[model samples]
Target: MRGPSAWSVADRELMAAFVSKVNGSAFCIGAHSATAERAYQDGAKVRAVLTDLDSAPVAEGLRATLRMLGTLTGAGTVSADDMREVLSAGVTRDQIGDALAVCAAFDTTNRLADAFGFESPGPGGFEAGADHLLKRGYR
Candidate 1:
């Protein structure tokens, strides 16, 4: 499903990392950010997205999706204009749906992980885990 989306794998993973950060789930932030970094083959893109989404080196479509996801992390509902932003960026309805699915799933996972006191491995562990996931997949 994610493979066919307009947003690349790195973009989706970066969104997950961003959502984790917004939710303050340290475990998820470490894990997802490492995954995004590994998918991007480095940390620069991930850093850009996490540090300043507006200035991230991604396309307008991805930037809009990221912005929508950021708003999604809040307690309020997503407005039609948010969807418009994504659409105006050339993201298809299907693509937006995929992106929102990723964000929503991560939102639940981050909360669960935090509520359960899931401890993150250190930086080394994050990279190692990401490598394992890339090689073996989440299944």
Candidate 2:
């Protein structure tokens, strides 16, 4: 959400997908993965991240930031040293905040989805929307 306005839309979706996957929200992960694929002309990147965060081919800075978010979500605390590591990797304060926001948002959403037993979309459900957007030159 921070960073240059020209930051890749696909990357944002990838971030969302990554957060969803980390939170174990199948629906969001699938939906955002499809969204990112539609925006990037390749869904594999999203799939890869969903399957394995550390292996996802994102910028190193983003990887470090996401890793921090993961630790925060899992441990409920982000130390000053963690902040320094991400900053040293070139992540801006705004970017770090946005990453935290995304993580927090997804955590809430995941709990809601789980509590309500929200059903996941069927396979390929995201493709239709993604394909339509692609045709409209969203990518």
Candidate 3:
């Protein structure tokens, strides 16, 4: 999930998990959640965000981006007005673009995971995968 963008690895991972959650992709949710926890060094925050974004302790920009992505993933389209809301939350268009790229990638991955009936390997495997991702990234 590493890339040249303002969004940190933690944010990208969390967004991936969130998108997977929205798509009901259990494997990607657990996998990306583990990576996000490792990146943030705090698993509770990821749980909080998944449980409820409004109460989660994250930046408004990130929250706004997540909300926008939720709508996009759920609906398969993002209206210009919804994008305006994200931009109004002090999230620059470039940052939204970055977040959108992450969301788009995960959306496809989540779909493939569901279509193929992927399953979570287990908590330990998730952690190990997270370690690998944090160290090696997507390159």
Q: State each model's CA lDDT, in order.
A: 0.86, 0.73, 0.92
lDDT at 33, model 1: 93
After superposition, which runs of candidate 1 have C-alpha atoms over 4 Å from their true positions? 1-3
Better of 1 and 3 by TM-score: 3
Which whole-number lDDT from 0 to 100 does residue 84 have in model 2?
96
- Residue lDDT tens for model 3, 74-118: 998999999988888898878888888888899999989889988
Q: Report lDDT (Cα) of residue 43, candidate 3.
A: 98
The Cα error of candidate 1 at residue 48, in Å, is 1.5
Candidate number with greatest lDDT = 3
Better of 1 and 2 by lDDT: 1
Q: Worst lDDT window (10 residues) for model 2? A: 1-10
Better of 2 and 3 by TM-score: 3
- Model 1 Cα lDDT, one tens digit per residue, 91-122: 99988889888888999999899889998889
What TM-score does each of the candidates earn? 0.93, 0.79, 0.96
Candidate 3 has a TM-score of: 0.96
